[model samples]
Target: MSTFEQKILSTIETNQLMGSDQSAVIAVSGGPDSICLLHALCNLYDKLTATCVYIDHHLRPDESALEAKVVETHCLKRSIGFMSITVDVPAEAEATGDSIEACARRLRYNALEQVRSDVGADIIAVGHTADDQVEELLLRLIRGSGLKGLSGMGFKRGRVIRPLLEISRQEVLAYLDTHGHEFCHDSSNESVRFLRNRIRLELLPVLEQRFNPAIRSTILNTVNILKQEEEFISAESDRFYRSLVRECTNEKDPAGHHSISFATESLTTIPAALRRRLFERACWETGCRPDFQHIDTIDKLLAKPVSGTELHLPDGVRVVRQHDSLLFTKLTEDQGPRESVAYTIEIGQEIEGSGSYVIPVLNRQLDIWLSDSDPRDAQLMRIDRDTITFPILLRSTAPGDRFTPLGGPGSKKVARFLGDRKIPHHLRHLHPVLESDAAIICVLGLEIDERCRITETTTQQLHIRWVKP
Candidate 1:
């Protein structure tokens, strides 16, 4: 067997990335690395069925399609199954607020997975080589990544495998030359606008010429050591994470936010490093990006053991403490106060999002008759009809909006009031408050303005029933 075939077989066996009976899907882009990988896999693993896939990012419309055709023809000439997909990476980048490269990578992986499922493939092989690994290391280092990022991409991540990770780009080109194989050269790989291209074309050459002649090998060795250390730490952290976690529940509402709780005592006992990793994993599970500041905030909360403490993280995920437990929920944008619609209502008019009804009743007897206790009585609020002016403005809590909650002394911030009730920070915006002539007469669900409380002398009442949509 040739050296290229030997390396591919060794990488596969070392990682145990595939089974002999499994079919493999090769993500080919008609580039040298992918072309070399497809050729090596076909030659080395005759026992395994293989398919070649090309993803057209649609950035270089005509060029990308040509590359796909080259790859398709090569696959067919080799008698291997072939497939091609096109993605609008620029439009996706705009829609997702991600960089074009990031969006393209995400869409590419999604498309690859879709093909994988359709073909019932066991593994999706990619052509990421040691050169890409070194470039990624430098990128992550500049971005302030921790050990996990320093480890670089793994040989096997989920169903995606990199059979050429241990091989270099020079080696791939040499192998292709010896085999007399043709492949397309992507012009984007020369663009300085992309960090990877800059590193590959300019930075690596400088480092190799001036610093270390074998910088690529040196970085790969470092990544290998870091990856091993990371694996041990990850396993230990996962063990501790499972021990500390008590329950995870999702809100039944459409927002689909999750509620994750950990034992406060057990959490405080964990080492700070492992605890941070555990919290980071939890935040990632909830689709929130865990930063140092947010992780530190949670660490402080765990040490202090405050019952009602809460932290609002990025991505609209709310973390609330209920006694000894922490609840994580993703607050939908529609559930937030920023999306609130401001409107004025007269007698018998209803609030828009709050679903509260305002009905004018004649007397205390009529108030009791209309307010026969329903299952939703807890959401109902009663106020003296004569005390409020017409056209009361119904809106979400504004900054500095203060209200005296029922049976409470003095006024507190609407935000603070909601926090005290264990409301997820993101949902507080949806908590409606009624402003009558610039005075807060009610907080839709929790309390009625103390001044608006119905009394014995009040002959008429404005009955408000809070309903959730």
Candidate 2:
């Protein structure tokens, strides 16, 4: 085996990047780093199955096709599987308002993940060298990144492994030359419009020549130390997270939202650093990508003496400070607060004798049927047929909407009832309440009105269930 291939094998074994019987989808970009990785992994086909995937960013249409062909030719010669995929990075960037670089990276990883899943591969191997790691660390540092960002990329993250991460770009070129392999040079890499290219082509050379002669090795050493420290801090953060955090499954809260809650007192007891990490963890659990500003804003929220203060965050996530707990909720796009429209169901018309009536606007369905036996499930409300009036109205709560909850002493306003149950303020108006000609029948998924409750003397029972998606 060549020295370069031996280095890669050592790195793979040391990190346990892949199992002996597992297969990998190698992302070959037709560059020296990727080309070298592809050849190296293919040479080890005796131990593991390998497939090559070329992701075309569609930035340079003419060059992309040629790059794919080069990767395909190499795979063909090695008798390995090859797949080509094209992604419209420009269109996605325009749609998402993300920069070209960010969009391309996102779409490229997504495409690679899709290929990995399609091929049933155990892992996706990418050729991110030590040089790339140093460049990434410098870029993130210039952008004012924290400790985790300074750590650079991991050797193995999820199902993606970087086998050549310990190898430098110069070493990659040496390996390619030794094997007499040709690779494509992306012209975009020379363009300074992207910050990364500038760092690699301009900043690093100056830093190496004028400042430190071994700048790359120095940065790599710093990143390695940071990664180890980050792992330890992350472990501690996880310990606190598991002990303090709890998923909120409150039935009164609106559906189609993810929520997690932790006691505010517990947050105060932990150090500020761990508290920030916990905040990030909570936001991640609710599908939010929170930055430093978001975490700082949440920290400010923690200092407030009052409860019920909420701040909107990216990806429809909202952090609300309740009386004793902090609630992080990610609302669905369609679940935003809106004026609820009234939906009506006439006893024998819209909702026939025994059938389900869907409310498309609310994304809910009402299943009503006649039952001789009483409903034991709290979700299924068994009402006395004689108490209900015709043409039931399903509408949001109004000023005068009041109902005596089952086994309650007196009538309570729907708004106050929802507030008492800890329903979010934005979702209060969206809570569905069934109203008959005379009074409010029930608050769906919560409690039925006392007057409509089935009694022992009642012979006929009508069971109504509200289903949410």
For lDDT, the strongest prediction is 2
Error of 1 at 217 (Å): 1.2
Candidate 1 has a TM-score of 0.69
Q: In model 1, state the lDDT of residue 35.
A: 95
Error of 1 at 50 (Å): 2.0
Worst 10 residues of 1 by lDDT: 362-371
Off by over 4 Å in 2: 246-252, 331-469
* Residue-by-residue lDDT tens digits, candidate 2, 409-463: 8989888889888999886654677766547888877889999887888876767
TM-score of each: 0.69, 0.70
Q: What local distance difference test score does each model get?
A: 0.74, 0.79
What lDDT tens digits, residue by residue, belong to model 1 across residues 186-230?
A: 999889999888888898899999999999899999999999999
For model 2, name the residue pairs that clash: none
How much is 142 displaced in model 2, in angstroms? 1.0
